[model samples]
Target: MQDLPFDIASLHAAYESGTKPGDVVAECYRRIAASGDPGIFITLIDAEKAHAEAARLGPFDRVAKPLWGVPFAIKDNIDAVDEQTTAGCPAFAYEAAADAFTVAKLRAAGAILIGKTNLDQFATGLVGVRSPYPIPKNALDPEIVPGGSSSGSAVAVARGLVSFALGTDTAGSGRVPAALNNIVGLKPTVGALSASGLVPACRTVDTISVFALTVEDAYRAFQSAAGHDPADAFSKAVTTPDLGTAPPHPTIGVPDTASLEFFGDAVQAASYAAALDTLRSEGGEIVEFDFTPFYRVAEMLYGGVWVAERHAVVGPLMDTAPEAVHPVIRRIVGAATKFSATDTFNSLYRMEALRRTCEAAMAGIDLLCVPTIPTFFTVADLEADPIGPNTKLGTYTNFVNLLGLCGIAVPTGTRSDGRPASVTLLARAGQDSLTAALASRLHRKARVTLGATGWALPEIPEPAPTLGPDEIVVAAVGAHMSGLPLNGELIRLGGRFIATASSAPGYRLYRLTGGPPFRPGLMRDATGGAIDLELWALPLASFGAFMAGIPAPLGIGTVTLADGGTVNGFICESAGLEGATDITEFGGWRAYLAAATDRQGAVP
Candidate 1:
């Protein structure tokens, strides 16, 4: 039992084999004791207490509780009823009166709390060593610094102490640690998880994050925890797409050569390059874009009023007991005093502009992929220069939340120096599933062991999330495809990408004569070819509005997939083909467009 892998799939296998949940809980405690890492937990739940929680989970019903009897931890900053949330500042510790919104949801899903993990003081630093308590030693290498401020949570997952754990991300708290520790870190869209019970660290952008051994596990934990909370002003209701395979040919945006930053780590740079190759091998079209605007947004995190947001949470403590706060945190948060309300407003305006600029760079790109951490930092390196290395660690991560983007950090491969290679897949807010889907593919491609455990990565199937009563699935054939011109119309109506598929044979595609944005029309014919198309789920309420916008010659009709499954999609009237040119040999509109551009030397 001690040797059983802590991954959800493996653990559930043990459960199906009649292994008692209580014994599994006991084994988690045993693993904790054997880990020799006291710094990992700020508050360890009693073994018997945890067992009681597991015991309460009645007979196996994964349907009622997807996380049944699964053991996990939360960062010390998040509230769990009766537990103290210290935010890594001992003087600021207080017992939580209630479970956080996410906590209650996870518990309701049958996940048992193992303990509360350590973090940087006031959640102010990225290096994970700012706590008054002992810093968690990096699970991969003791000489390296554990990433923070979600340090212990990441370390705990990396060490296989738990199946998954909750952390928080404002800058790179959730993701950087996952990279350093070689695990999957899911930094959800801000407000996707409520902030009501969390100790604030830039409250406006802070999100409860999840760390797990695999993308599927992290996503499952996220699904269990995420819900709209009316109590949290920042919370927004966003739809989470089902976990399916990524688009068949996604346009992946990467940093241009001049904008790529590795901080002199050749191995890290090479690892990132290799990861891009893996993405390409997996059928992604890599598009290089200017990453400079993103860097400008990152600078605003600590350079402006965002620091003031962190200070807002700890200002009173700093005023009353300056000596009680960690010196590093005091220095970081204290600097917030320099900004006036005017400075705050100006910074806000600047951030908006930078966000827009960065968004432009992401135009026509399905997703962006970047190295999770620019380079590695050692414990000794932090001791020599505490703030510099932490700042460098945020080089790729700080801009994400500021720009309202969601990302997941997944281990790609091992660097030449034996350190982990990780890259984060980022997409616009509410698109967490798309990033996770690609990250999962990338992780599987690497074939690396899970964290420091050496357990083989589990082979898991796509989780088929049951669609809600208010939802409807639609197939998109041309401009409505993701990253295409008219795709935003679908998104504005809450359309979420599901998967890419090919239309059933005998449906010929043609470039219908039209104006402004050229559109494609699919017509049933005797010798038509299978054309590429994307499946998207939209709200049933908005389906009428989408349907109302369909122009002449293009109307929604039942289109059969190559697999024989049918979906409602754009179909053309036979009369609409009068002036159309058949492009069936191109297979898809995107292919035909590419050929047209190559021949005509301009976009169609």
Candidate 2:
């Protein structure tokens, strides 16, 4: 019991193997006491009450209650029933009669409430020090600023005091802290998780985020919490897609050299370069794109109308008790008064133009990878220049929500100076699962220990091929397999890679004759051996268009997999096999292509 890890997988295994939820709850308090960081939590639930709630959870029942017995903390901004909600402003505190929409959802899923954590006042600053409460120490190093306003939530998870903690991200509150504290931060798509009961920083973009020791835990918590809530007008009916196997080769976009900024930190720049190398090794093709338009969009988040949105939430308080608000926050949000209705419209117009430019910049890319924070800032640096450091900390984060993108920050490695190195994966809204799937793989590839807990990442098995009910499974033997030239056609048709599998015994694979970008033909064979192929899920509505695109010998037909299950897949007419090269013995198209490349290289 003493050696148990708090990651969701390990904790659930412990529960199944005879550890009780009461004991887990007790251990959470023990870890919190050992941490010696009172700043990490604003208001903790009584130990007896937390244990009582755990007891009510009964046994481990993951299917019915996914977060059964999981201990989680909430940022002070998000409400939990009977808790005082404070957006890091003690003067603005109020007793919440009910839980935030997402919080209630997690609680209903069998998660035990631990406490309300600290944050920047009104969730205004990226620096954790903007709070009225004592600042949370950077979990890794005391001198460094714990990234905020989700600072305490990230620290609580990093210190292993909780399995996961909820935070809000309008402009990187969720991610900056995770990167600085060496944890996983998942800023889900806007409105994917209900914002009802959360203190508004920028109501339109605010979202509840998750911090955990592992990507799997964070994603699992997300699965439990995400759904549509009619009570929350901002909520969307977005589905948390199954995270299947990573695409064999993904095209990832990186900021061009000229547009990349590290605030003169060369070590951080080199670390980012190494992180990109790791992605390349994981079968990612790195494309450097001009980030000028994106950076301009980022600037608009703080430079324009968005600040007014923040002011709208706290303006009356600012006027009543200006001194009660953090001085820095007051100054930042106060600037909102400088803009007029005309200015607001002008900024919106500019934002729309920039959004178009940024979208164009990302047209062909599957994911955008960027440094979670361009540079690290120390407490002393913030003390020296509070505004500049906080603004700079948002370098890669501020624009994400503004552009309607989803992002996750993952720890990549440690710098030579022992600081954490991290990269964020960004994609269009509702592509949360795609970025998370890749981030999970990348996190495992980095081999970094979990947060500051010294717990090694648990071994993550390759995801099994799966599909949602609304999708149709399609198997591809050659051209449409991941990394193949024609694979984009499948992607354009909304296909998600499921797995690489072998066809049921008695299938023949051949390289079709006569084409620059040749195709493959799969046919039934009475005495044939198994041939390798890939399975993907296409939306039911898009299946027709996909079938229409097939030409000549290739057409959709029922194909059997090694597991004795059948799915719609590609097959060929017997006539198309004329002059074709028998490639069944190569196992798969990738293997055949590799051998061909080797043979061609040997020619000289």
Off by over 4 Å in 1: 463-466, 482-493, 499-506, 514-518, 526-532, 544-551, 561-565, 585-604
Candidate 2 lDDT by residue in tens digits, 1-604: 5568899889988888898999999999888888889899999999988998998986579999989999999999999888899899888899999989888889999999999999998988898999989999999999999989998999999988899999999999999999999999999999999988899999988889999998888998898899999888889977686676778677888999999999999999999999999989989989898898887877887888889999998899999999998889888899999999999999989989999999888776777999999999999999999999988888899999999999999999888888889999998887788788889998988889999989999976777767798889999888787756577677666677888788899988888886656788999997777888888888887899999998988899999999999989999999898888888888777778788889897311
Residues 244-321 of candidate 1: C-alpha lDDT, one tens digit per residue: 766556778999999999989999999999999998888788999889999999999998899999888999999999
Clash pairs, model 2 backbone:
none
Q: What are the lDDT scores of the predictions, listed in order? A: 0.90, 0.88
The TM-score obtained by model 1 is 0.95
Residue 422 of model 2 has an lDDT of: 94
Residue 360 in model 2: lDDT: 85
Count of backbone collisions in candidate 2: 0
Question: TM-scores of all models?
Answer: 0.95, 0.92
Give me the candidate number with maximum TM-score: 1
